[model samples]
Every structure is written in C-alpha cells, then in structure tokens.
Target: MTAGSFLARLHGRTATGVPRWAVRVAYAISLTVLPSGLWRILSVDLRVPLMDAPTDGRPPPDWFGGEWWYVIGLSAVSETLAFLAVGLVCTWGEVWPRWIPWLRGRRVPILAAVIPAGVGATFNTLLWPYSMIMISLGRRVDGGGDLGLGTHGWQVFVFYASYWPLAAWGPLLGILTVHYYRRRKAAESVGVREDGARSPAVTVSH
Candidate 1:
C-alpha cells in the first residue's frame, strides 16, 4: 500500500480500530525528530559549524566537521526508527507482510514484537529526561563541561527546541506498546470464548 493509505490504516480509519489519537501520537513522534534531523543535515551540508566545540579547548574530532555521511546516515536511521512506532497500532503488527515468503499473512505472535519493544521502551524512557537534565545543567551527560555552542543565538534556540521533542519519544512509545498489548490480549480472549462456545458438550453413557 502507499504510505498514505498505510498510515490511514494505522490511524483507525481502517478496520484495525486503533484509536486515531494513537496514530496521531505516532506521527507526532516522527515529526518531532524531523527538526533535529534537518538541523544536523544543514550543519553538515552547509559546513556552518552549528554544534558546540568541545569544552577541553582541543580541536573536535575530524569526524565532527568532516562527516557528511555520518550526519545523513544518523538522521535517516533516527527518523526511520521513530516511524516504526506507527506499526504498533497497525494491522501489519499482528500479521506477517505479504512479501515474506514463509511467514506471509501468518498471525504475528504478540510477544515477538513486545519483548524487544518493551526493553527498548525502558531505555528510551530513561534516556530523554537524563539528557534534558544534563543539557539544562550545561554539562554533557557523557561527562564534559559546557559544549561552547558558540554565539549563534537563533541556532541555539532552534537546536534546543528541535531536540527537546525527543524527550517525548520514549514515553509515547511505551504508551503505544502497552495499548497494543492490551488490544491483542482482549482479542485473543474473545476468540477463546467463541471457540469454547462452539465446542460440543460431553455426554456419559449409562
């Protein structure tokens, strides 16, 4: 399906019945990462020196200013991963994609997605707050002093505004994950009850 149609299905416009807001939140998560990605891209592509020089007064690593590939690659990876959250509320999450030769159209075992996502959610949830706190304190969480972000006032504001959205990513992902789990469990329980009701009753012979 095209991306628009695929997104509609995830948003409860299709039969999946995932709440529209959940899909919106997933989309928001994707959007939230965009500004930061764009900023990084501009910094590297334009060679404008947007990021802070290191606090130690030593020259930054060669990769810092020279790595166009790193900037592009990192942005692509981050946004792509963020977009995956949309799958949680989509039908594709519960069924194998048609392109998969062996598992195509088969039911997805719920926990297969759940366990890894849950673990990731835990790490993600902890990450943003810590990072924000460190940023606010003007210290790198990795143990450095002020990054000397330079005197570009608007750039600093934009940088913080863009990056701050990331703080919501983990919490939103965790919420979506839980909602998916509960929805699948409820469906499974209904299926079990229906199956039980259809079974023939036992009878004893005298």
Candidate 2:
C-alpha cells in the first residue's frame, strides 16, 4: 500500500548506491573535461607536439588546412553524448522534456536505453589505455608553451592521470544499466493477456 512497497513489488529490484544527483554531477564533470581534450584532437591540435620543437619560433599550431571547424563541431557533439549519460541517473531520462513536441513527457524504454549507454560508457572507460598508447607512441600530443602544463615524459602522463572521473563512467553506468534491465523486465512479466490468461507483454509502448 505504501510507495516503497509498490516500487519493490513493481520493479523487483532495490535502488541503491550512487545517488541520482551524484551521477548527474559526475556526468557533468566528465562532459566538460572531455571537450577540452577533444577540441585539441579535432583541431588536429592533439598532435601539435606538447614540448615544442625548440628550434622554430612558431606560435603554437594553427595549421591543419582550415579544416579546424570539424574539430570544433565534433567535440561539441561528443561532449553532448557524455552529458546525456548523466540524464539516465536523473528522472529526466523518463519524463522531463516539456519543450519538445512529441517527445515531451514520454517514457524511455530501459532496454532501448541500457544497450547503447552501457556500450558507450564501457568504451569511454577504454580511453585510459587509448590515451596511454597515444601519448607513448606520440599520438595525442597537446603542444606548446600555450598549453600551460609541462609536456615532458612525466607531464605527458597527466593526460591519462587526470582520467579518473572518466574511468568511472562505465561502472557507474553499468549499475544503472543493470537496474534498468531488472526494472523493465519486471514490468514486462507483470502484465496480463487479453484472453484471460496470464502472459507477459510483448512490447512496452512507453
């Protein structure tokens, strides 16, 4: 009869750990830092060489054949995806949008959400290794005295070092992913057939 009882019986799962707000904040932090690193790459700025050549009087890197816009645009998009992950933790993923025409107040399916997000979060976690490879093999270079941070061997290590928050992206998402699947599957099984027999619903229309 109570709210807690209803949720427990309905969802068949316990909602625990990583408060919704904390997840949202985590996503926000990840989203911000990600863009900075991404802008450099998309601008082809990542390979600009962090320590500088020490010979030429060059002024950072402005040369990438004017295709710099691609970097700017894409970085924005990638970061947006990171931001989206935050919504899953909050109720927004379900029914918060009121500005949109058809999408406003619509329910998002758990499976529809979990698969892509679980995959993306896992992939994002892979950045640590990828970044390491890029740094060691001279791939993800940050470039110049303008970067404000040192570009030495130990300094170059910071690229991966600062990735703690990002690394948490997957496991945190994984917990939500599991919670969603359990809740959704429970919803499916609790439905009834029209023929007066008990049966699971084929499709959830939210």
Candidate 3:
C-alpha cells in the first residue's frame, strides 16, 4: 500500500462529516509531546546526562536514584494523554470499544470527551506561552536559577528543539475538539447511528 493509504487505514474510520484534514491534524496532535517525552527518558531514566552536573561537588538530584520512577512514569502518562487526541477524529470517540466493561457498544456521551479536552486545551494554550516568556527573561518557570542545561550553543538548542513542538499542542487540540463537536452534532441531528445507520426521526403530534 502507498503511504497515504497506510495512514488512512492507521487512522481508522472517522465520523461522517469529519474532514480528511481533521483526522491528520488529530494524529499530529498526538505526536507533539513525543520529543520531550523521549528526552526525559534519555536524560533522567537512562541517566544519559543531557544537562550538566554542578561543578561544586554537589550530588546529583534524587531523581537519579530513588525518584527515577517518576521520570519514567511522567513520560508514559504524558504520552498516553496526548495519544487520546486520536480518538477525537475516529469512530472510537463516538462509540466505546467492545473491550470496555459496562460501556461496551454504547454511544459515548459528547460532553464526556469535550469538557476534559477543552479544559486541557485551554490550560496548555496559556502554559507554553508563560513558560516561553519566563525562559526568555532568564527566569525558570519553577523559580530556579538555571536549568543546568548550560547557556551555550548546542545544549540550549537541543533543549528547546525537544520541547518546542509543545507550543502547538494546545492549538491543535482545540481545532480537533471543535471539529469533533460539529461532526457529532451533525450525526445526532439526523439520528445517525455509530455504524452509519439512520434511525427514523420521531415527530411529535400537536
């Protein structure tokens, strides 16, 4: 299969009226956090030392030992959350998968997906800009002195490059959420079932 066809299959079936571009955007949103997640795994969990150690004989942070699990867990959790955006443009978001216990084969409540995603999108939209401003002013978002990544060329470049894609995360999620809302609303208006069947509309007699 061609690359385009492969991606189409991989993305699964989208809800009726969801534009092709929206499906691609949802997939892209899911990948925005990946570089930073991988960077954390490499630097902390694997102890690759992407940042410099203190020169004054200070010991490494607790994350190097007892707290190492936190680094791995954070990366895993963040990636999983980002990946959920894929469901926004796919059938799985409209209907719960059969593997789910009580919710299996049931139509998913629209608000159940929209509220959390909308909240997340709003939070991220504000967060990354604040972080960039703080960093630009030579202040850490956590109120620390320096990030220990050094002020020189390659270190700074690598650090920013790893996380820069996060700036797009919020906007992309917001777009996907809007598209999801519109598509689901259209489906509901016509009494369209998850499998594309249209139920007869009931008319109320005056």
**Model 3 global lDDT (CA atoms, 0 to 1):** 0.78
lDDT of 2: 0.53
Model 3 clash count equals 0
Q: What is the lDDT of residue 184 in candidate 1?
A: 74
Stretches of candidate 1 above 4 Å error?
A: 1-6, 9-15, 48-65, 192-206
Question: Against the unseen true structure, what C-alpha lDDT does each candidate score?
Answer: 0.72, 0.53, 0.78
Clashes of each: 0, 2, 0
Q: Write the per-residue lDDT of candidate 3 for residues 155-205, one digit (tens) a residue.
A: 667767887788888989999898788888988888888888898778999
Residue-by-residue lDDT tens digits, candidate 1, 109-163? 8898788678767887798778877876678778699745553567678778877
Lowest-sum lDDT 10-residue window in model 2: 9-18
Model 3 CA deviation exceeding 4 Å by range: 1-12, 56-66, 142-148, 201-206
User: Where does candidate 2 clash, by residue pair?
Assistant: 49-143, 50-143
**Per-residue lDDT of 5 in model 3:** 78
For model 1, what is the error of residue 197's alpha carbon versus the real structure, in angstroms, after optimal superposition? 16
| Best TM-score among the predictions, by candidate number | 3
Output the lDDT of residue 67, model 3: 75
User: How many Å off is the CA of 111 in candidate 3?
Assistant: 0.6
Top-scoring candidate (lDDT): 3
